[model samples]
Target: MEDFKFTISKFLKRTALVLVFLLAVLFVFAPSFSLAQVNTGIEFGAYTGLAQTDVRIIIAKIIRVFFGVLGIIAVGFTLYGGYMYMTSEGNEKKLETAKAILKNMAIGLAIILSALAIVQFVLNTLLNEYQAGPTGETTPPIGGETVCADCGFLGSVIESHYPGRGAMGIPRNTKIVITFKYDILAGSLIQDSNNNGQFGDTLGGGNNDRPSAAFKIYPTTGGESAAMAPNQFDVFLSVDKRTFIFKPKVLLGSALQDTNYTVKLTDAVKLADGSSAFGAIGAYSWGFTVSTVADLTPPQIESIIPTPSLDKYARNIMVQINFNEPVDPLSASGFFELASGDPTKNFQNINLAIDEGTKPLISGNFKITNQYRTVEFKTADECGHNPCGQTIYCLPGDKQILATVKSASVDSSNKPQAQITANFYDGVVDMAGNSLNGGGELRINGQNKIVLEPGVKTLNQWQAASGKILDDFSWRFLTSAILDTTAPKLTVITPGSLAEKIDVAAPLNMAFDKPMAIGSFKEIVLKTNKDFNINYTYFGTSYDALGQKVILPTQKAVRTTAEIAHGDFWQKSPTAPADTESAIYYPFAPSLLNDIYQNCFYPAVLQNSPRCVVGDISESNKLNDNTPSCFDLQNTNYEGYCSMGEPCPLVPAPHNP
Candidate 1:
């Protein structure tokens, strides 16, 4: 029996050894299997699967290991308990205690088995459904580009995260990934500080020396709705790896309020086909309300046309207070006054009309008689508040108010006949309680009439007169010469009406309204101012050969009645003659004649009876050829009687001799 027991013990020892060996093998291989469970892809589902499986599996595996260790302990305890029980021969209490210990060990083993069974059942029902696919491949979490529709933000692909879209749209601080089809030149991405919807100082050009670039994520007036973004985004060329990324600490509200945001890809500047650079592609402008609110009130004045300073002669008629703005009709009219009688009390109502065509001008025609003089006006705001401290004068400093005293005609008696002048007040107040203290000068016809000496603040009334500021005056200033507006009129020379013939030798002098320029005369124009008619032939009295003067042949010949009957004598001179009234004379011609028979040679013949005697020579030559009496005696016997040496003696000088 002892031998049998010994053999049984050996067999039990071998079985225990074999179980220990198997447990060691399982422990060694279990870590490898667990590592397999940890394998995951860069995907949302993978992250979820790992999150869900890792903890549970690792915990259960740990409990399983604890159970395995406990099981070995239970077996060892059982053998030890039995050995104790055998050694307690005849000791009832000790044997009973050993049996109790053995019983407790068995009970503990049963409880562990039951609990493990319960856990396995729970895991089978809950986690088993999440088992590896039939292909034995675990699916990883899926992640991709996600856009935040609510806040116009985007998010990057977050692997292993469930609900790839951020919880509440994209966070304001997400970095944006601006991916391009082609690589972006790093230097090309320009940061616009002015926010003028452009990228660079030169409007659209950019530096494009580098391969990739990046910038902080921000909203723009133009962009894709579904693009994912990081808090900062990198712009990279199409490459195996990202090129550059920009990171910025984005202020959620302070910096962006009331500011416009815009952005663009510089790569668009370059394309296979020619394309527009920046603005053509369109800039993205997203407006945000900055913390600061703007409140600015336009300039204002009470009265625009103001009073002019008084003088012995009235300076300017119109009392105007040029308002900084178009005054409310009801509130504006009563502020003006004519300060002629009383310094502070006399004020008048002024008419108002906005100058519409080109420039900002307000014009009104006002009446001011000689008795009423100084024009004055005050400007006040609707609330009677004058931005120009209430000293009746407005100053410039944070405030802009202007006043103008437009000029108008005064009574003729009160206006200066020789020099018309007007005055404008500086730092003058208006109805809106504003003043004109700065900018530009008091100009007349575009010229700074009043140079605005350092102390001169108010612009005086603009003075105008018929000749002072007329078009002629303007032309004079421009060309530095006087221009005549009224044309010159002519009046006949004064003389008693005379029927009697006047002497042609008398000089005729005429008068004119104004003195003419000295050098304005020309050679061909004849006038009575200088030379008179005189015959050149009459100047010579004697001939070179004969004691009497001989007539030299002139290209223009004298005419007789017979020549006049042919009707061919008038002709223009080849060269224009100098301005002179000279007469041509024959040797025996009568040089002196009056207006009655001046121009044509026909009238002069009848006026000069002595000159007709020369024609008798023609009769003598034609009739007798020898003796003057012979010709006359034959003429008497044959036909009409001929006077000796007379041409056409009976034919009445051949009708024109």
Candidate 2:
């Protein structure tokens, strides 16, 4: 401890001696350089040294140089102190010594800066007082030379007025005014050699100062810009020749909303002394977007699936979404909210995206397709089937699922593109980087539960139709596929197929186990078993299976229709044999008949469903029961309620649907 204290004391003594030496040097030169020059007027800048026009400038420069040398020394000490601190490790003595060195360096720098600032202030204040007189504070000195950074020895723009850079909501009648660093060559521009009061020079070829133009404005929308008619705007120079202006003879009508414009000071513009306006330097241009009206156009959500339009849905459904415009994909990770319809819970009852339960997520990745306008989310089941190793099928729990899309997922721009609750990651955005409104929803796949009873079951095909793997596009029953192959039953026939003394006037009628489809009866031909020919005209509305009942004329009244009545004989042809045994064949095509369910009519005594076993109608099984009902034409019963043995109940009427 004694040795450490000795070392610190010796270092302090050395630092004190150095400071005293520097102070002595400054004091020695202080007399030669007047310290009280508060009233002395000086104009030369601190840009030069030695024998300059201004004594104050020389002193300021020398002081600055001295301070610069100290700054370098301080920097060196700082670096060394930092190295000592780091290398000291756990040595308290060395670490403390390094810290002290750094502190002293900082304090020295502050003192040097304060002294320099004091000198500059005093000099400037004295100059101002001398130039402006006692109280009229004079302005600061500006650039006197024509020089630029981009182009050597070139002048630049210093000021402007009206329709300036980034100026918005400009009035249509407003004109452009610009101030350059140097006075422009108006003599060459307007060709004032004749000294005429009016300007009619071909040198200023275009109104926008074409060829060697002075100033021009263009539309930033990348198309044909709005233009004023010729002679509508005139360009001229101010009296001092430093300012240029474009004056309009007529009104501009209205400025475009959300449109930008670019203004440029071409390089062709020359200075008053015949030098380049920018000293042969570069052109200067600036642009800004403006609006005559407030920008209120926001991004919109084009569509979403599992939408309200879908009345029912199944498990393993993906969430599909669409936007009216393109949006940032990275910010779309926040488009999420999953909950149940139980009303008591927020997200507990739902398991979306595989096993992603009620736990709220901080991030999500989305796949954008359909021209980058569509968003799709694959469920666990969907992903699993496609080898993505995720399953997202719905499990039995709440009947309804409630999902929502945050606005931040859509609008990822700097400002709110719309008045929405959601922001960049949670909402939507347009290609213009406009954010979408916040309020949005992610709906449930279905409203009610679909009971899965025994036998074959099939899920809807539309939901699985999208995505990379293209899942069979349909779901199947856990067991096997079941189908109904039972053909329709022909229960009863009206006119017997073989009747000896048949009433020919009685139109034919048939009944099926299920109501036979309309327009079933096909062909009816007349034949005789006798050796002579039988040419009886067989005509009677063709035994309509779907029409008004044909009522035969009363026995006493004259038969008006040309139909074969009772006791009618067959008409024999002239060249026919003595007896042609002709039989009336009512050939029926059972294949053309069908039931309401599209099952073709099958002719059998009794056939039960499932196995569709044919059985007898005695006590074993009854085929004439109402289990398979039909329309009774004889009783004029429109409703197909004619069960063979029982009275036809008030069944609904049947049409050819």
Best by TM-score: 2
Q: Write the per-residue lDDT of candidate 1 for residues 247-314, one digit (tens) a residue.
A: 22333223334332332233233322334222232221112222222211222222112111111111
Model 1: weakest 10-residue lDDT segment is: 471-480
Per candidate, the number of residue pairs that clash is 73, 47
**TM agreement with the true structure for every prediction:** 0.16, 0.21
Model 2's TM-score against the true structure: 0.21
What is the Cα-based lDDT of residue 515 in candidate 2?
A: 27
Off by over 4 Å in 2: 1-160, 164-168, 179-183, 187-212, 220-233, 236-244, 248-260, 285-657
Residue 393 in model 1: lDDT: 20
Whole-model Cα lDDT per candidate?
Answer: 0.26, 0.37
Q: Tally clashes: model 2.
A: 47
- lDDT by residue for model 2 over 363-426, one digit each (tens)? 1224443323445553322212211111223322223444444443222242433222211122
